[model samples]
Target: MKEEEILPKLLSCFKETVEINQLIQKEINGKDIFDSYYESDLYKERIYKIQDLDTSIGILIGRLYKTSINLNYYYFDCPSQVYLNHIEEREKIYFDENIEADEKDFLLNEIQYFNNPEVNRSLDFGNFDCYSYGKYIDYEERFKITIRRKLEYLSQRLEKYNLTVDIQEETNIIDDNGNMIGYGTEAIVRTKIDKEIEPIETKSKNQLTANQIILLLQEIGFFIHPKIEDASKVKQAELISLITGLHQKNIKTNIQKLDKSVSENGANYQRDIDKINKILDDLV
Candidate 1:
């Protein structure tokens, strides 16, 4: 995938991780839930799903590291640091007198692999002893920390890009005759006037197929159960109704609370709200 595509895919993976983590937390740590819930089938199933997502995240991070290196981007340093840290851990393991002789020998033989240019470029650390056989829980905790730091850095950078785009869109105004009229607040006012007078398109039930509607709902952050995708039309329709109610209620609550002035990224908020509304209108 291209460098630009990796970031959005990573963000989606992060979102899935968060949702799954929340479910696990609620099941295991919620006020009324017992600690034994961790051993239940439901918890095991969610943990399996999360493990799959974590693997995907690792592969994506590797890909992102490769892309960053190819583009000579500064973000490459983050993954580089991860690799360096891993190598440091391996060195410590190699020197530790308590470790098995075979393990130290294995590390000594493959230590050059860690320094290989191809290995460095790929950033695939999954085969290392720490990841594959050693203290896995400790390795996983470190990996989670790495993911959190990268997510925070990427989110801040993405927010800056969005702010820059919003500012440019607000200031750069072109008239119907294809001439630049003005800039700044005056341009924003003209743009708002243009939008206010624009014709509204009516949505029809036939405009989007059932599958398309399902995809749109997913795009808007609604978690439609996978079984619904293969269910009967009646069942799918029922699921959609339930999701629509939840989505609309959330919008209603949040929209009322949003301040008219200096709202947190109002452009993105309105855009998502519009998408949900359009899907609702089409379904109607």
Candidate 2:
């Protein structure tokens, strides 16, 4: 299959897995029902089906990674590593005192032996059967959690390509006027810029002081990731270098768009084109 097709296929598989998990949760809502049906053929069949889907997802992820590498594209950390991080976080929560002892034990057991049931059985003299463990656990809830974590890991892997499979509802940002400005972190960044920065008129870009430039960039949400708490403390040369690098990145992105418009659409953007040429001339 083509690279573009893999994302859609992966998303479909995830959707099906989520639907099945929800159905299982609905069917086995109470503890007694979950314990009784945990070992039943129907429940086991669905579990195996989910496992199969997970295998398919893993294969697709590998293919996507290979394709990204071949294309020389940047990607986030490996899905396996993301999943491991999730497990580590859960383990930390399990160690907290607020969690009950029985709950902690169940979580610990699941964390350690989830992928190796045979090891669990061997170590516990065949007395640590998964079905028996279900008596103290909500099997369907655990299954749902596992599936959601898997989705999150896979989504993080695909994020660089802008192909995230959103499993939860997103929060929307509302302005003081009660208008929806945007959603998530992007909206927060936009609102920050709008509220904190007033428009300033400079005769030329070169006339703007280093401190002014730094403040402008900060307001425009440039120093967020690395987080420069005080741009004034940075050396003048270093601040200029940062501004130069940011300018180059912006130029590269906008120039590509300008090129596409001029060449393909034959758009008459001569005035803006001349402004870019003037900027380049000034640099020279």
> Each prediction's Cα lDDT score?
0.43, 0.43
The true-versus-predicted C-alpha distance at residue 257 of model 2, in Å, is: 53
Task: Report the Cα lDDT for candidate 2.
Answer: 0.43
Q: List the residue pairs that clash in candidate 1.
A: none
CA shift of 136, model 1, Å: 12
- For model 2, residues 1-284, the per-residue Cα lDDT tens digits are 98777656766776778788998998788768538788988889999999898787767755755564343322221233344645555556666744655443534343323323222211011233211111111223333354346545544544444433333212122334433332211111112233235332323424532223343443456555454434433233355455453222222223233225455522223433554456556776
lDDT of 2 at 134: 19
For all predicted structures, in order, the TM-scores are 0.27, 0.27
lDDT of 1 by residue, 183-204 (tens): 1111011133343565223333
- Worst lDDT run of 10 residues, candidate 1, spans 163-172
Runs of candidate 2 exceeding 4 Å displacement: 31-34, 69-75, 78-284
Model 1 stretches with alpha carbons more than 4 Å out: 30-36, 69-73, 76-284
Cα RMSDs, all models: 22.3, 23.3
